[model samples]
Target: MGTSASKLAILDIVLNGLMRRYKERVPDVGIILDAMVSDGIVKSTSDIENDHIAFRTMGVPQLGVKSFEKIFLHFGYEKRDHYFFEGKKLDAWWYSPPRATDPRIFVSELRVGDLSEESQHIIHSYTNEVTVDGIATDPVDYLDLDNGEAVDAFLHQPLWRTPTTADYQSLLQESEYAAWVIYNRYYLNHFTISVHNLPEGYNTVASFNDFLEKHGIKLNTSGGKIKVSPDGGLLQSSTVAEMLDAEFANGEKLRISGSYVEFAERKVLPEFASLPAGEIKRKHRRDGFEAGNADKIFESTYTTQTGR
Candidate 1:
């Protein structure tokens, strides 16, 4: 635990577990990987670099970013910039991975208080279950973060009772994110592919988007097919969260949004442009995330993006 290397190894196991479950839950991940192979982008899925993975959490007592972030922080990830999605009534932060090769982490929390009284009621009615379950304080507080398996299991575990269909729709009318966590609590929201290092044609967002469309993958077109930072150093695109056949309370079935796949192209810094590609590294690229770019990327799960 004292050595970063030891913790990094454990972190790897946790990350693999997250990706495994995410891919199984979101078939688009498998579809995208297969397309990458067929198009000769990479020999296999392992040849792809994961740019980052994201999670969505509820902002309530004993939860949200502060509680959820403890797992990664214990390993080696460093909390980075703060981002607020005003329109979406959410707050988020990006974490720098323990190692340069590791994927960054983007975590967003629903501002439950920002919601209307009824919406807050719907959210608390479910989150309160976590508290009632005897996790009176932060659930992560009881977790041994060094145990990779335990942490992995916790991430995939449901934090609250399944919401009734009516409650889900009610939250959906206010915050799409709230409706999502009510059912998909602590699930890996999405994992990103580092597209900048891919082959020439498939390395850029535009080219990657073209390759994706050819393979019948749906892109989140909220901010258009491509979202670029004003500095033009970061580019991103993601698949719309595919609707999953979810069984709600009382055996009620409905198709709701699940996770998705994201592609990111982090351009080399102005100073590193002269360096050969082989010599360039993560430090030589746009390091963190962009608020504007991430704002649109968030809609990958929103009905506005997924319904199409």
Candidate 2:
């Protein structure tokens, strides 16, 4: 899709944040993508723990995936179950890729042989499109492998750019790129910060042309991909930078960064932090909840630092 690079940039940012927060507890990369496609956002920690409580007491969580199969069949947008693991169906959320919300993301379905002469000519027009390591190769063979699940070679190896439009005549083309969205978590102790209000250096730009022009970089922007500069190229990222570069004529940048202790002091240690706690206790009493296995204990310990 035309916006594929932009979306990838966003995913990179969210993935980085998730890794930093949960570390080992953070779900796999695949799970993050699947969740993004269906819900457009990942659940908060409190939300996940709440669902876990629901499973133990009420046998259901508000919206969390119950089993792995539910994740695949229900959330992954898969029509049928394709794989399973050790009698327990694997969660599709961990396997499926995220889809772009922007309509410009869908591309035309081109058949192997039925491609028009114009299409074939267009495919050959590009210098590096039909090559394996820049050497000419049979396009038919590439298409054949592409039809199968040999996407790693076809998509990554290089091929003619595909138009991400339902009809070729439209002005608004779809993006073929994958994307996922993440919300600022309440647990992160920050309110939902808008794109505006970000500091200068922590921002990223989304539109390729805007980023290039603003930064005084030169590149041909006719098709989707832009040629990289000899220098380190545009530092594409999903953080506040993109928001700063958005099509907002009157918008300001957003900034919300602080230490873990600062976040905890503001949000988790506040009186309202107990909202989840209250709900948990209430559910336990109503359902006669029995703590399962007793491996992990839900305890809160707070320590304050005082400067001398």
Candidate 3:
């Protein structure tokens, strides 16, 4: 079969898998699955698309994700990119905070391609160092209250300070779920994946080893991803309309979420073009170096001068 047909056929299989699982396990695991599926922040080439941050830092109890189908119908399904990952699709739904922007709600569809290198680097850096508590401690920990305490309470720290091949293998020997989560977050930071649409491919399935190498990129052969659509699913109308807005549509508005319009109008817009500049020359000089450029330094003695 053709690549597209193969992809779509695999999607059908994934959808069936999700449906069957949902039927079997909704009452038991639906809530957890719903939150995880809906609260996704990073966008892969394929996974869950149309992540509408209805509430910014101040609103939602946790970062939430849900499909438009689930929002409108309370029923949804997940699919696969091709034949990559298995059993990775989700049909669950979640509830997030209400919007504070225009009466009409807007959803932002951010693809892996849309992020800057610095942003990607931060994500990558944090992924390895971050623990579940570290990640959830700030916002979700404060927001999601279960009997005045955080839900899903679990201490999360990096399995290894510096992961090698052996580290990954060792992680696999531990909880596979935790390993995959770390892998996914780390992968999200380094590479750029396309998120063109939904009902198609949502997350890339390429293996990390292959990604590091120059071989062909591979989608997950086991787990499935959410669907993609050219129009960005429900975001087409909301985000596309933002593009048409006279004041905010011009790319500056691109970074700010629609939910933050009030904050933008009152605070962010005034400081929109403002940036603080600091001189690094003195800091560098203070760290120690004679005013001479050297082509080479002692490899053994080369060191960053420390601040007094």
Candidate 4:
């Protein structure tokens, strides 16, 4: 397949795999995604250019960002700048795509050691379960990666046993990040729509937020409705995660917040756009993500935000 074809094929596999598993827990993905198309948000799923997709993982010895990033690296993505969140205990890195049109990848790992001892033990117990089961595998196999099966397997694989209600409560009290990864292992946290590519009236995050709210979608308002970078190069907003039923190890089913979608609009740098078209050597749009922006976006799935 050609570059565009190959990108779409991989995305199809990832999105389908994610939605399948995500819908098992939360049904809003299909509802919102389908509505976006049916309501003319974009021509179709294929026409929606993604700015990035994010994954959340535990920062344990065996499993974390390192293991998860291999899948993208095999597909020819290169690691880019790193971001740190002191309050959230997260360390993330965004990867540059092999092809410019391909959506960028963002993966963040919770610093397990930084949490309270009880929270750390609860998280480690689950990561240990995944490690013992040998669910972790190399994502660099050419045949499997090219065919998109490997990526699907990686995303859908269960890396941890269910957490007990008591343990989950303990983790949640200390760090909502820990609670999230323990229950939802290796699932797509959120996928972003490139707002800059949207049609004239909807090309900005503000307008897109207006459109989403009109459809009854609630957005994260922790920092603000829209999180803008200090330099005003990146603006972002996200829907509050939908709450869904989750069965714990103790045989208790309870409602919990699940994944949500995000929107981003990257502004063109004045210096870059002012250059003659042929003379511009670098990408015109702001390239990296803002740590402050992402920190608030991560809270979209928190119980306090989702109110599950």
- List lDDT for all candidates, in order: 0.89, 0.22, 0.22, 0.80
lDDT of 3 at 93: 22
Clashing pairs in 4: none
TM-score against native, each model:
0.97, 0.18, 0.19, 0.87
Candidates 1 and 2 compared: the better one by TM-score is 1
Better of 2 and 4 by lDDT: 4
TM-score of 2: 0.18
* Top model number, TM-score: 1
What TM-score number comes out for model 4?
Answer: 0.87
Off by over 4 Å in 1: 1-3, 132-135
What would the per-residue lDDT of candidate 1 be over residues 1-308, giving only the tens digit for each residue?
A: 24377798899889999988998899888888988898788998898999999999999987999999999989878899999999999999999887777899999999999999999988888777776456557888889888899999999888778789999999899888899999899999999999988999998999999999988999998878899999999999999998999999999998999999899999999987899889988889998889898889889989988777
* Candidate with more favorable, higher TM-score: 1 or 3: 1
Query: 81-182 in candidate 3: lDDT tens per residue?
Result: 111111211112223212211011122112212234543343344333433555533333332222211111211112224333333334334322222333
Candidate 3 vs candidate 4: which has greater TM-score? 4
For model 2, how does the per-residue alpha-carbon lDDT over 1-308 read when each residue is reduced to its tens digit?
A: 23245444443443334334432222221232343234423243222111010000001111112221222122122232222221111121112223322100101111212334553333234323445666765443434321222321322232333322222212111110000001111112111111111223312223422433444333222122222222322121111111111111133322212111100000122333456543533222211111211100110000111110
Better of 2 and 4 by TM-score: 4
Off by over 4 Å in 4: 1-16, 19-26, 132-147, 274-282
Residue 28, candidate 4: Cα error in Å is 3.9
Q: How big is the positional error of residue 134 in model 2, measured in Å on the Cα after superposition?
A: 3.6
Superposition error at 145 for model 1 (Å): 1.1
